[model samples]
Target: MDISFGETCGCKGYSVRSDILSEYGPSMANSCGGGNFVVFMTILEAFIRGRCDLSDPCNRVKPHSEPDYEYDFIVAGGGTAGAVVASRLSENPKWKVLLVEAGGDEPPAAAVPSMIASYWGDPAMDWNYRTEPESNACLGEPEQRCSWTRGKVLGGCSVTNGMMYMRGHKRDYDDWEKSGARGWAWKDVLPFFKVSEDNRQIGTLVSSEFHGSGGYLTTQQFPHQPAIAKDILNAAEEIGYGVTNDLNGDNFKGFTTAQTNNRNGSRMSTATAFLRPASGRSNLHVMLNSTATRVVIDPTTKVVFGLEFMYKGKKKVAKSSKEVILSAGALNSPQLLLLSGIGPKEDLTKLNIPVIHHLPGVGKNLHNHVASFVDFKLNKENATQSLNWATAMEYMLKRTGALSSTGLSQMTGVLNSKYAEPNGNHPDVQMFFSGYLAGCSRTGQLFEPLNTNNEDEKTTISIRPVYLHPKSRGYLTLASKDPTAPPLMYPNYLTEPEDIDVLVESIKMALKFGESKILSEKYGIEADKTPIPECASQGEWGTDAYWRCMVKVATGPENHQVGTCKMGSPQDSLAVVSNELRVFGIKGLRVIDASIMPIVPSGNTAAPTIMIAERGSAFIKNMWNWNKPPIVHDHFSSTDLKRNCGGVRTDTNDVKIDIQTQEREVVDWHKRHVHL
Candidate 1:
């Protein structure tokens, strides 16, 4: 009776057609004004469209030849975390390292500035993973499966993720320390971020204080920031957000242009930064299309000797003369470990797997940056090319026009949102403002260029916020003993009352932000006023009720999956590894991936994930004795960055309400369109 779009197995599209179901599907029901049409159409449509969101099934592709084994350490999953780990560890030429990825490098589209849009659910670049049915968000999508778009190629999710770079508030790390995860404090881990960054102090808006210099990963101001940034900031200031120049700064209370991992208008994935630099190295063996099955362990001693992988068809063994690190990401890293029998005893036994270790936390403590969004429809005007290559081409060819555009390929923002936390310094939400709209499909096909609409659009703002400190925990367990079988994960979201509260507040903030007079005129947006059903039903429908509803709807994982193999002090029960990231009960086995996150950080996981590898490499090099200065970038988190002379801090809900209400009173704040 209800036609949903954008989730897996669902009919996903930008347009909403009211009467769609009567035209399709099982048992032939004719709710439409007349006759039944039992067309075998759903399957065909799904088959055709679904392929756009994910990779072609691995079995369908031709297999590559067997790989030659040569490495002191072989890192699996060449994503954000993997690339950093491999790059750092291999810094020693005396050591040989091999980085194996299921997908190879990226395509030209991945390198294009505006074409960052093409990275979504791209079959070649995306893992196109679907989560088990969620009770929430993928409205109007096919199949109701929550679409999980992870990267398959090198640079992992960073290659495909929205390029927002926010290291969460320092309080976040302190909490992790309080929860038994020691030595992961902000002061200690910041160096890793600095080591991995090539910070650019380009923007006059945010200060260049803490930004790193000449590091591998490129950091910059958005190329083309949808005119929304200033208006949103102004409105947020009116509403009382503690506007700051940088969200990554110490106060963590402000709104500003999002920091990104882009260079010259294109995304700078880790592969582009680290692995690509050493692609020609003879000692660096990079394997593509290879699926690692499990760690080859010694039967007599619980030592991981090598890795068993399937490249093409033949099973191959890549001996780890030194160590076998699992960088297979939050999802697959634990999956690989479980298949190798290093997990919860019950799970391994059920799958008929050998029990190498009885670590209960092998796949527990999952956290994600879950979100909810507001869709506002605005009055339309004649459409013009957006600020990307289409406009950039104008400059390239004619040496004029919108071609000089900043590639303002903005799909992101950086805001330090605050909650009603008792702690004075800590805030609850972090907002990311993506530049584009609902792309052609929510099944998330590789992004085709946006349709130059009937009007210039700033259509919607996705109000994303994670539980700053979540008590709700999730896990990844073995589906079967078979190495090929993927693990089963349950991210028991919104199962907690706190997480529910956080999202509802996030949506309200977004709603208020959109209502700001400055935002409305800039992008020409009008509020859709689509009431959230759950927000109202909780009977406690203030900020708390609204958040609960948002959680119920959008409470799925962001696929920045981690904490499965949680790192903590040895005495911690759920800990599968020490603070050093070495797996318990096993030698030469360390998890240098998102799977080792004791808790998920506040914003985009790529930056922190890479930092983990950077820090982990140091620790591993010292055999867990890494002693270095706080990872301070040229930029300082605590170093005050006054707004760019024209900014305010619109952080807390109370402050935001006051400012938002004022902005509501003054709608047309920006008099003219200023394209910088």
Candidate 2:
């Protein structure tokens, strides 16, 4: 019998072939009792309706059309940081802000926490990037290429990620200051984090000082979790690991239920938290389905003036009267700079593009957290897994059920490997739990049950042990001059043998949890005994050599890529932006996103990126003197201008003199100190 289903884009008003359904009715009934099939269809229909209602206009940011040719600020890429930066900068009611996003608004399915993996390879929602074939890693995958999934939607990867709201260790920020990112110490940037956070469990589940309250971004644990989650936490404690309620609070090293960026069982992306509140502002305009191609830089003056973009099959330019900020994410932001002739002179000349500034650090220092997947089997006869019609109904009516949470996947564990400092503040390894096998089918169906012939194998679960601080660095270069083309990525996963050592240690540590008395007695947990076929020749199955081989074969390069456009002092040769986030040799331009991170944080990157946006926005406001008393034109002299413009004041009496000149002088000062 032939059966056909509708598109999963919005799942609204979609139809199935009636004749095919009728033809296959009896066979489907025989395969899985008639009542069961009917119940499945009923739940499917209800899910479609709920998704459509959640994606309605009232829950999304309304796209703006016919934006003016110029604005006070033009923010490129309305992702995690871009959305927050644009929203905060537009608060003064006097500045006109334009935000350009390459993708459309998020779909209804993105709101469902359990459906996060459904968007992994979907071209409509993900960038679908793959690392250049690696010889040392990803041997099990086709052609040894690791899939790097970045979001193409408005909310960016936050719409496609696990939604874990991790802020990394405080020492991570102090290290940033020591690495030339001055003023980025833990104490200096904590307030910006609080300004964007609205933790629901501030006093009860988290510390009031470490967490925030009464802010836009709502964060809390999912309302529902599987029964197995408690057992997993108990197992961690039994294995001599500290268990805490809050990973983001005082204790960074521990095992606990994850705090997610969720609100009432739905995802609260940066677009939902920041953009939705500022949607009604006349000063803020969001341009969806628009791709920013290049930064328009004045050739002789080396000052950014506007942005070139593609919208509706036509090329257009938007002028920035004040600044053109690039928050296009780590991958795209550096690619845009290379396309705009702001990269190394030798490489630009090879591509026959005239060099604008010859900044050598445009696309260097790339890295990400990498992990290895380890599988285990649980006794399903004793476990209480509730992912059926009754739970589906419960979620549809009251938003409380297994479907409202990620189950055991909502738990995380952080511990220090032998390579890490023994201090609890610096955990080098992290663990992620997946309650079920997560993958997308060829037909795009999501969250399907694992198929296995063995009854015991049907209850398989996975734990991913991630190496948080990797020394294996990679870089990306432009594939061609076309803006629509993807950059050539060289993630170089596991290139360093030290990285493999860390993964092997992490894998050993995770197996201890499976062997703990609590998990063994309560859940009947056992590690999959099958040895990796590719690693069989390395050593004994449980030996360190065998685990090292397994790491190379099943490499998991996480989505937390950062440090391509690292921020540092003017004296640092590889610094793309200064401590203030301004491009060293250019005027009216700054990069405020994950790309500026000198070192990737110890955990997830979304929360820190938002903090960077908040801090960077404040820098822009202070530099422009927003809300400060307007400089009295009659008394505005060179001395006042010098103090405001970093001592680059012009001697002209005209108060309306082009501020661009002063900006150029400031850039020149930094350029002299920057190693060419």
Candidate 3:
């Protein structure tokens, strides 16, 4: 074997003998387990070490060694939206921004797309929140409680999510506008979404009208995908569904390959995209491994002045001269608000905490996109393993392999169920395809044994039918007065009979793809016959009653939780924040994350949450008169500047503009900057 080795074998200061390389390389590629494979992996580790030696310090956000006691802005929670808000707010040299995150930075494993499952129950990465017991849902889970895994790292859930960049149907935001959250219509929020995205496939794969280029966050499809992904797309087409190139474009209801928040086959979390870019700014200071216990508000003025946090096991306070933004996400944001005495008076009194503001809707209206998984068995065996020496070598050398992509898990279908309007753009059901059945026993082994007769590996896939719009609402409250204690989360999944009906219809629709000629004939896909022991007595195997019983037993709550600190008009009693995201009865305080969502969007919440951060940052800048030059027009009349801009007073110019006029101007400004 004529194996050629140059001066070095990719690794610096390391030379490989042709004879040794020739012998081991071929053997490593042929089998996963062998002395040759072990030797090759040892050599690969040296190569990885050499590559790590060449890493640039500028790529990472170093923790601020010494943070000032006071800053112009104090952002609580350095998660998804919090990172964006801190970065955008620190753009001005005059303002100092402090970002406090409870968790540390994202680990090395988080960069790999296939390693997403590794973070679910990990205490270092996930908050590991579980919902309170529900009668109708989570029947199969231990104690009938569903596990809610939220990211605790700097990037928050973005660091631990599937990375699908879905903006949802335009009607989803329009519905928010109709329901008291004025100026949140699709047209108003679309510019922010475009500005935040730096899509790698603008003119080629996606429409220029819907995507932007040269932005902070990079959005692109993974370089490689499994062969089954194409089959899934074909199956969707065979089942009378449109296969689209861009799911976020004109046709919202369709099946498409995933466009994710990735750059060069790695995850581009908000911390990586937004915060790291702003790390060089002297005005921005990031404090990691710190938990914000409470927002200190003046009882007399009902104004937030500073935040109380614990760092290095000692309580500390960071004063905010301008504003304090709560971007701690849905669960923690409201929990922090209640701890600061900004919730219902009755609840605060019961906890013996003095109420600074009697806000009745601090932790109300909690809900999420719930799903149910249906297992399918393939006649063939798994040709490739997700994690193996070959895949590891390919990814390490060329950044292309199974590790580069999420396989068929990235293929998604958006369709309306029988309950939704026929032939409408809005979709009620979103289908997720997985390459493996996610069922695991208490010992973390597969529930069913693999068929060992074939030479290849046995394969079992899952089709998840996500009910996008659930009518049932839930709430969250303080489990205890202790800041470290987890909140009592009552997701109340499938409490309403209508919610179960939607899931049933969605499940049937997903089963159609398995029955399609392309999937059934080519892949020999069949529904898994494993009986749900609790659901068998409901009806015959495939009946609606049996499926309904199975749906409740196999309830899957997606991580897209929202509406706890809902944004709404002040007239609405449940309104925690105004459209500008300012807390109702408080001054110099805002919530810029997913918690402020009035209603959950039709799809994933990550993209929408980033858009909210962009819009909220603009509101702060506009009110403080920082970024754009004030345009004074005598013809323009301000109806009520207080209500329009959340009662925030501007500079000496005293420039006052209505919410609609300001939003239009901001959108136009962003439009001019964008390529399209």
Candidate 4:
């Protein structure tokens, strides 16, 4: 009999297993095949060799041991999204789960609560990516190197991301249903969001009404807002935002206290909360240092059958008896699909890769959060300590105080305009507040050797206003046939005029908040540029032409890339998966991670990503339990949105919708397992 495990222990990433592992293959191999990203290297080399620079990080880890075993589900990429998916799925004792992370698990030096301000310069935990070039944003900065930092360990991006948790406005979900992710409306998905989280600050039922009680994930509003955090919200309120403590409640369009995924001052990454707890479960398996190279499909019908990956130094395959879920993330998921012959025929043909199925929507319709840096500094006393060694000691030992703070003071409010327009339900703009005044210079390699004397010069406080829901779209494509090559990605940011119009309004909204009276006295905040320079060039700064030119050039693209494998109507050219998240025209295969987002959510993707995992876990459980039953870990919900979406479609006479209305077939089995 055959069974699969999840990821192996440690941060070695994912690898395959053979019944004959002892019979063949060497111990510790570098099958990354020439080019790949390295965990640590020189700053310049890292930049020159990174994915954004050339679509491949070009380095591989040389293992110290032999290849290990396989798991039931080998989740590729153990970052923010991967952690929640692996954790929820592993709850069942009858099945094994595996999570493969590309980066090694050693904690980054700046990951400590005390050194939060130094993360940008710390290479141990960051994946810095600079654009080829930009037209408008960061000013007076040496070079534009936008930093794309994400934790490479089990917690993934959660460990590295700003810990602010902002629940989007209700209209955000309303928009999804309108866009084609029909059953996933706000009210429908809210429970999953609440169910997946366990807030450290709120009461269970009171919070559990929208939060989980016994759930592993924990969230706490910032321990101390710091002068900078408090003033930003105060300033926002002065500009007309209704100040409130909770943004997760009814109306999200206002200034509010910051909420975060920190428990007792330590980062509450999904891995720390979800994956780590179940690591010892015999039914769950985790593999580190393994890379899933391709999906094995039935060449005759184009039906997906299993997957192919490298373990240690040898190749191995794992067949899926029921379903194979892809949670490898946006770039990699679509790349894997296209590599296995599931993307556009033309694109596939160009790389000389065979077309197993003409999946036209495979790597198209990309979406990303776009942002810009705005700075105002009055003094240094209120700023976060530049290099405070004493404070660091206190935080590490007791897990108390400022060191534990996630760099963000709060999620700047969601705004429709500076003044309330009696117009739409959705807010037109949103802003993220930072304690560090990061200029637009692209972040250099985290692996760069830092001169010990230069530690005190880091700046203080940055307020970035992200242009939410721009009409612009991007794409992901393979640079080569090699699986080791990172997918070529283009966010195609601000390509459309309509996208630019929305962003223009967003910048003005941020300025209004900066003018608040309460915030100025506390944080020493100031709006350096009274009127945003109109020109893209220095000559146009005070002119309307400069504003227009700056609008075009002044944006830092959101690293939250999604919609590459967009989920929507099959008739649409850009729709890769249906609302059920199944690959278009494929059988027994699905793409769950960030790749299937029909539209990006209101704020950060981490919270919403966890909710998606909760829903997907139910979908898989429902599908798998049709035959075999889980003997442990009782799931309480009778009706899950994912399972509900999978069934029942609404139809109009002139047109057809893809809703599946079949009855949930888990009655008798439910009784057997939970004794209901």
The lDDT for every candidate, in the order shown, is 0.59, 0.76, 0.76, 0.56
Off by over 4 Å in 4: 1-72, 106-151, 203-208, 379-387, 418-422, 436-460, 519-524, 530-543, 626-676
Error of 1 at 430 (Å): 1.6
Q: What is the lDDT of residue 106 in candidate 4?
A: 28
Tens-digit lDDT track of model 1 for 494-559: 567666666666666766765667656655666565556645565453445554555565454566
Worst 10 residues of 1 by lDDT: 667-676
Candidate order by decreasing lDDT: 3, 2, 1, 4
- Predicted model with the maximum lDDT: 3
lDDT of 3 by residue, 23-74 (tens): 1101111123333344543443333322221121223466863468899999
Listed per candidate, the RMSD to the true structure in angstroms reads 14.7, 12.4, 11.0, 12.7
Candidate 2 runs further than 4 Å off: 1-53, 380-386, 436-456, 627-676
Q: Please say which candidate is ahead in TM-score: 2 or 3.
A: 3
Q: How would you encode candidate 2's per-residue C-alpha lDDT over 373-483 as one tens digit per residue?
A: 788877644222334545554555555666677767789989998888766558999999887421112112233343323423446678999998899999988988889
TM-scores of the candidates in the order shown:
0.75, 0.84, 0.85, 0.75
